[model samples]
Target: MEMFLYYIHLFARNVKRTPLFFALVILTLSIGIGTLLANLSMLSLMSTDPIPGKSEQIFNVNMNTYAGANNRFGSMHVLRYSDAKAILDSKVANNATMHYSSMVYSRRADSQDLTRYASPTRATTASFFEVMGAQFAHGEPWKNEHSNNIVIGHELNVKLFGGANSVGEKLELQGKIYTIVGVLKPWEMRPLFYHASEGKAFDKTDDIFVPIEVAIDNNWAVFARTMSTDSYTTLDQTRQINAYYIQVFVELLDDKQHLAFQTFIDGYANQLKEKGNHRHEVDNRLYNVNEWLDKNEVVNKDLLAFTIATGLFLLVCIFNANSLMLSRYQASQFEANLRRAVGASKKQVFFQGVVESIILGIICALLSFVLAFSLLALYRQLFDELAPVAELPLHMLVIGLGVALTSSLLSTVYPLIQGTRTSLASILK
Candidate 1:
């Protein structure tokens, strides 16, 4: 430990001798590392499983139940209200829920402010909380599916009630009053699997979740894609019409449950076929969380391509840094020879260089963070659509540090070897 400290002290003295060279090395390394880290941070966030252990157990339901051959999306993964309700009522899976995206102007019912904020809402069933593993900070999911009770997400809770326990509080939406049955804890799910369509996969969780029956009865406007052969006048007509807009998710505990649920969906598809509802053959499919994200292509392809490009750029940076390190070591060769003449071994000289590289790595890591933040801000401006999901998580932060340290050490290897290998007498002359 004492020798290690002494080596670090020697490293500091070395840096003091050529501060410009040291700064240049760190700046060069930080630029490359920071650019790569920014891309990696967004990619990692996008690819992360929203629900870890239960991801495999939960699946997104997709069935080819649409009547038209020229489907806009070419995939009949979305469900009609009737079909969605039927599946939800089946109770075949351990837990199942169906939902559609809706938006409403909302405010606290008791507040003096008449202003209403446009809130992203979900018209879902009570099982949604259980299926999605959403935890409540106060109260619980509404027991009455037809009642006016609703659940508010943490962000909404913060906005309206100042982040306090908001249960039993009344919320007004479009001139209607609804009781808040639950207040969600801080829940953030990236690549929101339930409604991954229409470029909403990376969107935050809904501000409000209301019972599907209540949402329909109250005529909440659908904020999502609704396809129907017959035009619907109101949300209430959605149940009776063949309008396809809802999305369904179910939790099947094991392969047996998954198979059974698949079989059930197939039977239902056949029923639709027999009834002249569906024109095509039964093509019901269930995708696990990760599979669903892949199907949606939630992680942008351009981001992946950019990540690869940045990786190559980092290699180029390493080469440039190695060349700079070689030049710095060559200049210090006389000093290394003098130390060897005073009884310092080659191994000792090499160890000191390694310690110096590690110190440089630490400095590089700090500078890389500042550079990464600047690059990420630029990225948010360039890619506004992805701005919300661009921030770094703890794991990505640690990864950035590891990449910096590894890069610095890698660039020093050849330079450190050459610096220690030359004959002492020849270098001194």
Candidate 2:
């Protein structure tokens, strides 16, 4: 108990002597620690799955062909509704979902004038909702049995129907009156992979979804195409669906099954190509759940690399602080000599130094947490374009506290040791 009181006195005396230097050390350490904690929080939030279902089993398949004039690089393609149907019916995939895109016109129920929007008017199978892990806000997704039913996003629902429950409500698209079956909850929009690669954003915020069979029955040219009669084309009737653009997705049970399925798809595409049905080339670029997360939700490679570099830089700062502390203790040789001459024991003098170091560490830790929170908020505000507010996670608070405590202890270690080693006799000489 007496020892603790002595240490406290020592700490108070040291602070009185060098208040400004102590403040500077703590500020530099806090900034470095705060930046690291913020980045770790951003990385964690973006890469984790929002849904807890079996996302690992899901995968996306694109139609592709390797035939351009260069022939060195293959051109990717999307499947038509007919080709997608053949793959689904043959049970080549354990389960499959398909969707195609088109532009459509829409308007508010009260408004007479039509407003044209470049929406992804997708024709999809019933399983698409299940495959993509989408949740319906009010009613169920459009049923395959209901030909004229459609599901619209929450944003679209608000724009077209004033945000009312629009189940069984009517809306017009491309001269056809369709019944609204469901509305989707607001979600972070992502560009489709193929389109994203082409520098286009697949903004599904205003999208409308319908059943694939219904689209074909209505002879939607966006879902399928027929060749002109005047052309002397000798392509097989089965291969007539060259111009249709559709994306196919599959779900598998395990990695072994996934590889087997991928191989089969490759061979199947090869057979089609050999038979002169090769307008679009097929390539084997499949994504498991982890890969999908990395592509869509995780931080970009440049950001990740930059974060690591900054973390290393902070470590360097901590080391530099250690060196500075050691130098300060060594420069206090006259103080050590006076304490020794005043009959202070070697153990008493060393314990006093350790106590002062501990006090400084505690002060720095408290300041670091405050600084970290402020810096994190500023970081989100400044980089809102690259890192959204949604990227911040609650766990960052815990992580920041830990970083602050750890950094303080580490920075104080060298100073504490150097202070303890100062000899009263050597200092007096």
Candidate 3:
């Protein structure tokens, strides 16, 4: 109890001598560490699917090659309806989903408010929702029997009919009127595969989705072909869909089952090639469950780099704090010698120095928390336009506190040892 009081007195005296330097060291260290943690949190949230399902079992199947008179560079790897039917009928995959893209036009009650712009719209099967782990915010997705039904995104509903409950209402798409069957939740816009080829971010803000059958009957193969002069014919087409853009996702029982499924797909692709059905050749690149977890390599690399840099920066701050503490000890040389001469033991001096460092560390941690929160609030306000609803998770706060405490202890070690080594005889002369 008596030793504790002495240590407290020593800490208070040291802090009173150098408040500004202490605050600077804490602020710099906190900012560097806090920013790194915030970025890591964001990356983690974005790369994960919110739905509770086996997302790893899902695979994107594509036909990667085509045979023609001349090798074409940008030829599509899509299969036709017949080819998809054959694959699905074989039950080689756990589930098969077909998709196609088209330009959809829609309008509101007021023709003036109506927009007729080209949007990359999708025509997909009902299993698409299940495969991608999407849910309806209001109403349900279209049934297999409902050919003329449509489901719109939340933002699209607002733009077309100005309400969320636009279900059962009629909307015109591609010069055809269809009843709105469902409206998807905001986050359901994930796994936008179309943007993969376009090299752009898929904003689910404004897109119209409809049944695959309706799209095929109404939009697919509805192109005009113009013939040229001479015996050789030239075809000028507006939209020609020669193949089907379908992806088959499978959910196997175990690792062995997964490998078996991949081998089956490989064998199937070879069979298609042998049969000259090269357009339906399956791309055997299977993504297993573990691979999905580590999909965001860029994000992972960025987070790691940020963490390493932050750790280094904090180390530099600690070294600076230690240097400052050393200089202060040098100035108190006479005082330390006087105390030692008065019969204070080396252990007593060492304990007092450690206690002083502990007090300074606690003060720095509290100040750092305040500064980190302030910086995060500012960041949120500034980037509200870009990531309006993004936030740092609660776990990051715990991590930040751990980092601060650890940094404090490491920084104080050298200074505490140096302060304990002062000699009474050399200083008292």
Model number with the top TM-score: 1
In model 3, how large is the Cα lDDT of residue 26?
Answer: 62
Instruction: Report the poorest 10 consecutive residues by lDDT, candidate 2.
Output: 223-232
Q: Is 2 or 3 the stronger prediction by TM-score? A: 2
The pairs that clash in candidate 1 are none
**TM-score between candidate 2 and the true structure:** 0.68
Off by over 4 Å in 2: 1-17, 37-42, 49-53, 66-69, 72-77, 100-107, 110-123, 154-164, 172-176, 185-208, 212-241, 279-285, 292-299, 327-391, 420-429
Using all chains and alpha carbons, the TM-scores for the candidates as numbered come to: 0.96, 0.68, 0.65
Among the numbered candidates, top lDDT falls to: 1
Cα lDDT of model 1 by residue, 177-199, tens digit: 99999999999888787888788
Better of 1 and 2 by TM-score: 1
Ranking by lDDT: 1, 2, 3
Candidate 2 lDDT tens digits, 149-179: 8888777887777678888887777677888
